[model samples]
Target: MRPQHRVSARIYSVSLRCAASLALALLVSLGCSDEARPKAGAYCKISEEGQASACLAPAQHAYPAFFRGLAQDKLSDEQAREVETDIAQGAQSERSYEALSTLAYGYYRLARAASSQGTADPETLARLEHWNELLSKAYASSEKDPRYREALRQAAVDVGSRTPPLGLRCTDADGKPARCDSTEAVVRAMDEARDQTGVRGEIGRLFDRVFGTRP
Candidate 1:
């Protein structure tokens, strides 16, 4: 009877081992499944150059990753140049509101970085103007997007605090060219344009809440 009991125990142990092996195999198969793989057009599947070249494509959804990579200092000089070229092309082509606003943001960041070091260079001044121009275009294209309005307000505030003035431009409700010369003025204008009650405005607000606003 003891011998039979020992044989039964052995069989149970063997069954447990088999079950464990099967479970491991299943996990491995799932890990290597097609669903687990990056798609053919996935951002990670593209080379750095390829990613930069295609950065402006609306379908690529590459800006977030590309800018994140840039912030991490992951891109080489050549790759950075490619990305810059793509941004310029996008701006020139009036590709989309996203592209235009992204270009504006790039210039804004560059100008701010340079200004933080010391007196701004001629290049930095030019970049700030470009930022203003691109941002205007973006805002015109997507007037309902809160981000662009917020950007304009923030830039006005930032410039207001600086010496020698940024000389940024905006249009009044009457379509007259108005100078974005003060934080109060810009914020007031932006407030007038605010529309968080509508579906589009609500969606924009929701996105800002989820994303916590761009840097």
Candidate 2:
């Protein structure tokens, strides 16, 4: 072969080898990359300041969009590690509350006794407290949000370790006495409220939730 042609061939061969090595390296890297595996999952789809749900995200370092309880339980080591990473590095002050809530739920699932269906640790209560604080802020920002009120009620129920009591006060919007038709006064109040307020009986319902009613 000519001198220049031989040099050119050598250079071409070296370039081809480098490209092959890089591609192989990438393949190996991907093979080891647990964070990107669909076999595992993570939660990263978020829209609001304090809302979250699962979504099948594009191939990103962020967690998966959503998964069922069985899927969550089947999370791979990489998935768990990514969640741990999010709890550590990703949870800035801005996302701290949401991150904590997510972590708490994960722990709750892991720690709960299958027979009893209760979490092992009480510290989950602290994490839930932080979550509720975020929710309260959101609700305060938008009091008219029926979802926010429902969320508040759910949080209260979850943290209090009991179902929310029936709102117990008995009076009409005009502050007049309303007689109960049944022994269960809460249901009776709800019926009366529906009768008075039409579809938007939330006003009386709010009073019941705030003050609680007896049966």
Candidate 3:
């Protein structure tokens, strides 16, 4: 072969080897990631053929997006990481109530689940406390609205203990007195109350005023 052709061939061979090495590294990294993750078959009840990982995610990450993504069929590692970053960022500001609440409730629910399985640990306990503090900020930002108060109360429920009475006091859209015995019911009642009182419009206005429109 000509010297130039031989040089070209050698360069091509080096490129091929580099590509193979990179691909092998990627496969090994993926295998390690899988091994680090809790096995879906052991930790999850398969709601669908491929939903086991999604179902097991919230237990591992303790984030609302993971649970919501399971229902929406969009769960992913990237989404979980995004939610974690969002929550961390929101923790430093009063304007990110929605994100903070989501994360706080996610941790609350996860802690409940962990408690039930007798797997609650110091790390989880510290995280739950941190989220509680963040939730407190969100609640206070809203002027201690009855709805937010009930949300915190609901999160405080000890799932490992005997079921406690929920005893949520609320009002309907027509300002009718309402009561609930569960956290979900409390949220529903608050939603109905907001719909009735048109509080959501006010909330929207407040958001716009506080956070401004995204340019």
Candidate 4:
């Protein structure tokens, strides 16, 4: 039998942190709402505005809430860092993939958020690598067990992976024309790819010129 080849057709775009978002308030939308408190849920399955209360799965709940805060612009950069720190300390069932995956992701996202702010310390780098290790474990575990794939897919990429077809946009000083080119805007495009597809690692290195690794 011949060796099989792996091909992915997914096109990804690169994006940077919104330049003008420093003053943007947390955009909490309460419109199109649902308030059904699930009987035994940990996440907000209602998918409403304002903010998600919790996650259905205990392991998944923490990140959603934190990310929801981020999406809503509710959490300030400083506040978000606090949340990320707390998330890194999360715990689920003992020796459970879900728990470890969550922990690893929590640390990685913290790295991403902090990185955006031009803040990167030894602790932050350690946390990011730690998640990568956990993610690797989850990936290995997925070989024998398929259920763990989702866990790996979601949390693993943020640690430092490269997402392909990075769609990047570069704005000129005049702001006359915002150029969106995947080929020309390699740095920004790769960042967008990471944002969209959870790809990380090389993306950071490739964009180190534009994004800069440490503060």
Pick by TM-score: which candidate is best? 1
* Candidate 1 residue spans exceeding 4 A from truth: 1-105, 143-197, 212-215
Tell me the whole-model lDDT of each prediction, alpha carbons only.
0.46, 0.38, 0.43, 0.36
Whole-model alpha-carbon lDDT for candidate 1:
0.46
Q: How many backbone clashes does candidate 3 have?
A: 0
TM-score of decoy 2:
0.26
Q: Of the pair 2 and 4, which is ahead by lDDT? A: 2
In model 4, the worst 10-residue window by lDDT is 6-15
| Highest-lDDT candidate | 1
Q: How do the residues 81-140 of candidate 1 rate in per-residue lDDT, one tens digit apiece?
A: 433444344223333334443443344345445546665565545545544544344344
Tens-digit per-residue lDDT, 41-85, candidate 3: 221322322223343454544454566753542335554455555
What TM-scores do the predictions have? 0.32, 0.26, 0.29, 0.32
The predicted structure with the larger TM-score, 2 or 4, is 4
Number of the candidate with higher TM-score, 1 or 2: 1
Positional deviation of residue 202's Cα in model 4 after best superposition, in angstroms: 28
Full ranking by TM-score: 1, 4, 3, 2
Model 4 spans with C-alpha error above 4 angstroms = 1-53, 60-101, 157-215
lDDT of 2 by residue, 163-183 (tens): 222222234445575432111
In the range 116-140, model 4's lDDT, one tens digit per residue, is 6564554544444443433444344
- Model 3 alpha-carbon miss at residue 112, Å: 3.1
Q: Please give me the total number of clashing residue pairs in predicted model 2.
A: 11
